[model samples]
Target: MSIVNIIEDLNPWDKKLHGLFQRQSTEKLTLIFTTRENLDKNSRLRNELFQRYSVPEYIWAKVCLRLQGYFGAEDIFSEDGSTVESHVTWFHFEIKYPFRLPKNKDRAVAEHQPPTPAQKDGKKPAGYAWYKMGVVTSWKAPDQHTIIFFDAEDSPAVGVRNELKCNCENVKVEPALRNPYWAHQFLLGPILACYDEAVWNLRDHVKALEQGRREGKHTVTNSLDSNDRDLNESSTTFNALHEILRHALHKTEILGVAIQTLNSICARKKIFEEERYSAETVAKEETVQNMVITKRCARKIAVYLDFQLSIVRSLEARARANEARIRSEITLAFSTVAQLDSRVQAEIGHAARADSYTMVKIAAVTMLFLPPSFIAAIFSTTFFEFTPPEGEKVSKDFWVFWAVSIPLTIIVFVGLYPGNRGLSVRKHISSAAHHKATTVGPTVASPAAPAANMV
Candidate 1:
């Protein structure tokens, strides 16, 4: 029943009221929300809507315009028509930032690498695997429900009771708990993507097994012989399915490594503190407020979350690799089979040509001698003037002609057989394809192995 919920506060309402959300009733497990900031622990860079924008100028201008409007005035433009602004300054009227933007600022960005372990020397933070949690106080654990309760604060962003004072009826009322920093909707999709990739990977192993089975069955059926039956069939999908299972195991291992990497760097994500402190580390150490006890349990939690993340990631990756390999193999097999098909067609063509050639040879020979055979038969039966030549009669000389005819017939069949030798060359489709799983976990060069701490 212990469910670890990772909720990010996006708007001021979500930031303020998430802990106070007791649904219509109040019987649920502990709810903890965590947040990160660009400033001191309490003062987070509240509303950051432009994380992934390639060109932030247009959007930043809109933001500047909105800020100016918030103060009831027009936004100012610079003499060069460039821009400037405050960190969190309110413009009573049109206020422009005095500085110029860097050239190539649009193209200057890095690929998003997952947070690596925070380190000092070669060791991870003395306090490692930091993430925030909250225990929703309005609700209580009932019966065995206590098993699910995490005694930690539900969120590091502290002021809950005071923030929920706005009436629901007001049109312009500030939200009960909207985070000022990042928007939840945007993050929602990515978070779900991570979860989904993990879950779906676990599920596809079954399908891979099934596909391997089907492939195996077909291979056995296709034993090449005159009767098309074999003493034994080799290479079945059943074997392939087992191979897929083995691969799934590898994927699981890879995921474990990824999870560990993620957990080691969890602190980088964000953690809004309950007590106002200059930095997060100080807040965690100094607070007498509801705190997460760092002991054996913390390590266990870190290990567990890391492993889970890794397993999911590895499986998902394995599933994809397996799929790609399977597809490539199938496509290659198809290509091989295509060559087989061509050979088969050629065999058909050769057989047809042999038959036609044999017939042509026979028919031409038969037509050549048919008139003589008919003339000889007519003279012998009618006792007419078709007489013998020199010492030999026409009928008696016919035996001489047949001797020549027999050799010609033998030559035709022999020529035909030799011409058809290409058909006898063995037709073989490729019989082997292979891929499998591999181990995954902490590595010697893994980024998760904390190096130095960044305050």
Candidate 2:
């Protein structure tokens, strides 16, 4: 099927979606190996050589679906089938790569964007960013091996193309098996390279996190010593690292699946070669050479695949270890902050207790002099003069004053300083209440007793 037909059938709204983007045409990296010319050709065009092959319609549909950012029934697509005189396969997967971080003081920093004011002041820290590359590879029949790299720029793709150029003569020249699958190894090389780069980026990120954690430890120590409770920087760093590790782990899992896909391709290619060999009743010299080369290629690829798997495993293990380390650091930071908070709370409690003691002392002094001052002021008033006018006898009104003042003074003292005296007063009141209750109980029971007897 043609690429246009596949696109039209799979995504009917393709033309409408095109107007939304004001960008240039897609930058696709396509490598086409053709046996007709006995050479490989490079193209920037999308699906130029893919249309020349006898690829199954289903494969075309899968590629179309993947390009549209959707895989209908499965998240991963790996389909292989044989056509007359050729073997075909289609694969699609996403791989991650770290985005370029800005430089600071001749070193790459972990900040995804420019640091905000808080980050600049060391109140917050930033994390790295990663972007996903959607990659698709198609091995078409009748001498076409097409690899398509989408959403990637020229660097890695150019490197792959250059490597293929250097090695394509082996497959094309005489005495060298013209098995195109030999080129498959180089095709997959870039993916492994991408994974290697990603893992290294994560390693760098882990190192940065370790450094940050150590620094945070010192900062927290100082904060604890100085009684500074603000720990937003440490908390922010923890959260950022947590998020980065989560993404890194997920990408590692995808890498695992991708390695599996690579293994599957190698296995299926071997099986296809075997089937092709068995179906030939009379093996020509060329066929024998192709078979030998296919076998050797399979063995070499197996070793390579093993190496790839081990590398991925090692990288994954290291990533998980880094994650665990970051987690431990976060726990320690939290504990440190909690300890600081507890200390601050204890200090605050002591201060509050001291304030209460001071207040009590002031209250005691007030209670000591308050009654006499109040009494003197009252006596100095016109109504109760200590030195009366010569004609006026400081009369019986002074007795009245004494009678009112003495009792009032005693009541005021009892109310103001109700220490043990308050308890004694309460006990006396309780006794009176109990005595009244005892006396009333008999009278109340007398009525009930007579009524009960009548009953």
Candidate 3:
């Protein structure tokens, strides 16, 4: 379709399109801000056009909403009719950080000034204490000869625009190839920057987690004194590794989507290659060259995306390895703690057995002296006294006393034997019954009785 027809069909004045188109004339309205600077040498003219075409807040909001919905609801590589027909591909990407934003010190100070009523009640500000935030959605349309990047509130988008403007100004290109070359340059800058940042962050996080695992292993090895501390350290390291793996996986997913999008673009270029060149005539040499340039640039982009995918895959592999290492460390820590506990319990049991043996020896010594002491006490009693009477040298009944004492002592010892034997027998019987109950099977007497009756 002709430019006029496209504009008329688009209806720039319409409510939906007005915010997007309001800032510039329909004929000169290029989505690419960087290219406009190259197309116009005069800084004044570029500024004037930018001011005139600057999208209104309402339109910007709508654009953001559309981008969010498209990204959230559709596959990253899915194509629309606009992409197929016009040889334009639309892509959306996001960069996220796992950590929360540090609270804005200035904002915090301002809120605390004079102590707001909520502060008086000991409550903090209404917003998040540790703000978890991310950049706005970024969208790009890489057309056959023109690449348009929608402005967003994201730092990456801003960085891309600035880099593209600088590259466009510095690079000297033939008039025929300028658009095609710059389009690739524009698309490459943001993607590469983001990819590099993701790789750096992932590497650092993985390194930290690995370091923690090493430290935890060292602690477990050196000191068995604090099992709880060692286990806690291992748990922390494991959790960190899990987080890193999650981040790495997310990065790989985005990389894959990007690679797929570039592949789709390359596939379209290949399909239209013949038709694109066949239409070229002597009158359209410049147009033919531009198409050729665009095709070559698209191929380069696809190759770069493939390289990035490989890098991302490597990062994912590293993360997986770290995860496995952390898991192994956790298992080792648990095993070490268990073994230590078992050893401690065994030592306590040995100590208890030693104490029991000492008590048994003391009881044996006490029993050895008890019989003699009992005999002496019995003889010294009034009934069998052997002490001299009044100053007499000896008692007449001393021999009788000795004879009676010896016999009585022997009799007492004999009498005690039956009681001791009975007690011993009772103990043996109880032990035997217990052993039988524990180990022996019940016996059936019916077969024996039947055999006896037959005999």
Give candidate 2 regions above 4 Å deviation: 1-49, 54-83, 99-181, 215-222, 225-243, 246-250, 263-267, 270-293, 365-455
The collision pairs in model 3 are 23-52, 23-53, 24-53
**Clash number for model 3?**
3
True-vs-predicted CA distance for residue 404, candidate 2, Å: 7.0
Better of 1 and 3 by TM-score: 3
Q: Against the true structure, candidate 2 has what lDDT?
A: 0.50
Task: Please report how far candidate 1 places residue 27 from its true position, in Å.
Answer: 8.5
The candidate maximizing TM-score is 2
lDDT of 3 by residue, 190-249 (tens): 555555554444555555545554575455433456457766765565565556666666
Q: Candidate 3, which ten residues in sequence have the lowest lDDT sum? A: 127-136
Backbone clash count, each prediction separately:
42, 0, 3
Pick the lDDT winner: 2
Q: Tell me the tens digit of each residue's lDDT in model 1 across 256-349.
A: 4434434433332222211112346345333433223222233444454454555545545655666565555545444544565676788889
lDDT for each residue of candidate 2 in 352-379, tens digit (9 for 90 to 100):
9999878977887777666667776877
For model 1, the run of ten residues with the poorest summed lDDT: 139-148
